[model samples]
Each structure stands twice: as C-alpha cells, then as structure tokens.
Target: MEEISKHTIHEQDIVEMILSIGKKFERIVLRGAYEDILALFKKLKKKEQSPQHYYQEQYDQYQPSAPPIPPDSAELFDYYCSFEVHDCYEQVDFEGKGLVDNVYVPLLEKVCNIHPSLLECQRKRTYKYSGWAFNALGRVSHFLETTKLEEMNVDACECLQMLWDEVQVFGFELSWLAPQVEFALNMEKFMREVEKLEEEKKTIFMRIQELRMKFKEELYFLYI
Candidate 1:
C-alpha cells in the first residue's frame, strides 16, 4: 500500500476538506480554486484514471452529458431563514435576539454543515451573525430609549455604535457578493448570444456602472 504523505490527499478527504474550508474563507480565493478542485474531483470520479491522468489529452473537452439538478429545498430554506433574520433585525424588535437564537443559529449551523457554496455560505453566515449582533445592539438602543439623555453613558453608546458598524460592514459585504454573483451568471448568458454580443456587453457594462453609482450614493448613506 502507498503511504499517504502530508501533501497527498485521498479523494473523499478532498471533498470534505473543500466543504469545510468553504464555510470559512472569503469568496475570491474560494472561487479561484474551484476549477482545479473540480478537475481533481473529475479524476477521482473515473475508474480508469489516476488523479493526474484526468487532465491529459484523452480527457480533453470531456463534459458531463447531463447536468445535476440543483438541490432547491436546502437553498430555499437558507434563503427563507435569511429573510426572517433581515426582517426581524430591521423591525428593531428588542426581543429579535430570541428569534435569532432559536431560528438563525440553527439555520447557520445546518448551512455550514452542508457547505452549500462560498456565496451561499458567506451569505448565510453573515446574515445570521449580523442579525444576531444587530438585534443585541437594538436591545441596547431600547435601553437608551428609556434613559434620559443626560443619564446616558458615552462609553456604552460608543461601544454599541461600534458593534452596529461592524454589522453594517458585514451586511454590505454580503449584499455585494449576492449582486456580483448575479452579474457573473448573467454575463455568462449574455456572452452566449452571439448575435447580441456587442449590444448585451454594452448593456451589462452600463448596468454595472449604474449599480456602482447607486451603491455609493444611496446604499452607503442608509447603512451608515
């Protein structure tokens, strides 16, 4: 039997490791490594090929004849849980933390365990954590709501503001990733329509510029 070295990985280990890392990392690196990891997986999937043999000329232009159906139920549950968190946080319900504790945390744990993908993983984690943080901060705001202006401690308010700012930062990052992924997927479709290539490219570029301007001018203010 061949000894497994530190750098050598068995096929199943690779999948589990990819899934585990998928939960923790930022998107850029996660996406950048996708093709190589996928290639490795393809190799492992074939009975006749060694891991390196899968990338040779014999495997060139090979494609899966059938596309796998996306697991919609799991995706839908994550999205629903995410929306609930958003709604609860925005409503400024001081007891929103209860909902987060009972609902959002479990959703987050399940999503992480499933390791859906980087975009969804980051979105779920950020949404749940940010909602919980925001809800806690809201409770602090409620406390200050009842306290006389003169009785409020500057330090506590400052700390709460900092926590709120962190939540906003995470929310902004999560929101940006969602639209960016949408743009990427749309770009793929747009590129495929050869007859409309020039026009669609122009439209996509223009829309991207518009999104940037709106994000800077409108969304920035609201979050701040």
Candidate 2:
C-alpha cells in the first residue's frame, strides 16, 4: 500500500511538472505576441498621420449607399469586425491558416471543458479577430511589395493600424481565459504541496519503522 501510494504520488508529480512547463510555454508565446504588436504599433504611429489625412479626405468625399450595421448585432458585428478590404496591389498572401490552430484553438478546447458555450463564443471571436489581423498584415505586405516608397509608407501605416486593432481585440478576447488559467496554476501549486507532504509522510513512516526495529531488538536482548 505504501509502495502504491508512492507510485501514484510520483506520477502526479510528473503530470504537474508537465503542466507547469506547458503554462510557461503559453506565457512565453503570449509575451512574444505582445512584443510584436507593440513594435508594429510604433512603426505604424510614425507614418500614421499621412494615411489618416488621406483617409479623412476620402471619407469626406465618399457617400455611403447603406447605413452602417449596429454594433449590438452579434452576427453583424462579428462579420463586420472580421471584414478585410483586400487591396488590388497585394503581392503576397498572408499565412493565417495555422495561426489560431497553433495556440488559440487548443486553448479554447481546454477552456471548453469548463464552459462549452463560453468557449464557443470566445473561439468565434478569436478566429474573427485573428482572421482580420491576417488579412490586414497581408495588405501591408502587398503595399510594401508593390507601392512606391511614399505610397508604401501611407498604405503600410493604414494596414498596420488595422492589424494592430485586430490584435488588440484578439488579446481582449483571449483575456477571458485568464480565470481558467489561474485555476490551473492554483491546482499546480496545490499538487506541489501535496507532493511535499507525501515526501514528509514517507520520511516519518521510515523513522517510525526504524524505532520499531530498535524496540524489537532491545526486547530480544532483554529476553536473552
């Protein structure tokens, strides 16, 4: 029974260690994404004024055929939020197929274990936002490839701003996973404590056994 308990504790410890490593990897990936977004934001900000000026002029001159959809409509909002206006001058396609698959999808699957509907909503939102980002980045790449230096600066600023917005939205959606992550972290800590206690118990048991042996030997000597 003692041996079985030890084996079970050892297996639990291994599982907890693996989970700790997985959490660390997730945090590292998130930090990398955050840094990338910050760099992109700074790059766009430097050239953003030019594109804003041009867009404002265009906005003032253009007439809309249809009124904009209300933000409260979930389906419409999701579609609108994910919408990307593809530029004709796009030179390269964005490789977005595996972006969500790499992290968000798997994370959502884990979250679904806690709340399936919440997971579904978050998953949809994540994909929409990430898809918009992919499209925006693709447009930026296109502009860089085909546009003159001045035009590239303007388009890059515009596309990068769009991409930045999508990334921000994606980050917000991802934050919903925080509670689950916290719970998992707490569980890992609890498991560590359990492992420590188990070790202490084993040591105390071994000491008790040694004292029992000593008592038996003294009793035998007295009898002799």
Candidate 3:
C-alpha cells in the first residue's frame, strides 16, 4: 500500500487515517467517506479530548453501542448493476459506492428502527443549524411512505413540508429584502401574490364593517 503523505488531505488520507485509528475508534469508521478529511481531523481531536469535556468518555464508561452505519445507496446501486441484467451505476465514476451498500445500509436501518425518537428529532426543522433532520427524512421517505412510517412511531410525519415551509419563509423574506439575482424571479412572484392577498383581505374587512354600520343605522332609525 502506498503511504499517504502527512500534508495531503485527499480521500486516500482519510482512508489511511481511519485504518490507522480503527482499533481505538471503530465508531469513526461509520461516517460516510463524503465527509472531508479536515472534518475527520477535528473529530479525531475531539475524540482525544478528556472524558469530562466530551460524551465519548462518559459513553465509554458504560458498554458503548456500536456506531450505526448508513447504507451507501451508491454502493447498493452498483451491486444491483453487477447482476448482469442491469448496469445502471456504470455511468457514474464515483468511489465508495460499494461500501455504502455493503456496510452502511444495514447499520442505518437498525439504528433508525431502534431509535426512531432520535431520528424524529433530526427530522424536525431548525434550519439555522443542521438540516440533517430534513435530509434524513427525505432519504427515509424515498424508501418508505407515510403509511409505512406509522409503524415507526414518528410523531411528525410532515417533516418535509415543515422544512419546505421554513425554507420558503426564510427565502421569501430574504428575497424581498435583497432580491438577489438567483432569487429575483421567485421573490417577485411571491411578493406580488402576498400583496394581492393582503389588499383583498383588507377590502373584505372594510366591506364587512360598512355593512354592519349600515344595519346599525337602519335599526336606530326604525327605533326613533
């Protein structure tokens, strides 16, 4: 095996790092290869930090559970292609497609099945932070339907809608204020609809009040 250089931070360096730290940090191996080497470097530093500062120490205090590995969809597709009847993944020149299917899929399914609560939290909307919940929900929803999700005990089945709603809210406000080149078209259309609706609502309210006042005057006149 060719030894990866210390300064080079390519995918190969990550593979080397994982293999080097495997015995001490089997958990790190579960992360997707798509994660950058720099990110892995930060994670490795965190792992080495004192038990008091991090949960890994506390987690290891008790018998720690195995890290959950998500199935690599790319890998699974490649495996399917290899069946001779189909060769769909041949066109895409991507690495790690095989490992995703072989290693990550079963691990992710098991983790999701066991910890639907954790998954549900991730599925919640907090766009200011990580969008893992929405991303995870999209992936899961691609595989399973809302009816099937009922079996999993998820409280918020509308995670995707919520994510979209939040994005629209943020995008609408930002677009209206900044109207950047990318958002100009959508922003103008959205604002026009919003303004029309507001004007229509105000008109309806005024009409209702006018009718009420007319009825009141008519009643007072009849009494006099």
All models: lDDT?
0.34, 0.35, 0.33
Q: TM-score for all predictions?
A: 0.19, 0.25, 0.18
Best by TM-score: 2
lDDT of 3 by residue, 14-102 (tens): 44554465454433433343134335445544444432233223323221011111333435433433311112222211121111222
Candidate 2 structure quality by residue, lDDT tens digits, 26-127: 423233433443344344445434332443353342211100111233254335434333312222211322132222233333433444443343344554
- Model 2's number of clashes is 0
**How far in Å is the alpha carbon of 147 misplaced in model 1?**
2.9
Comparing 2 and 3 on TM-score, the stronger one: 2
Native-referenced Cα lDDT, model 3: 0.33
lDDT of 2 at 75: 50
Best by lDDT: 2
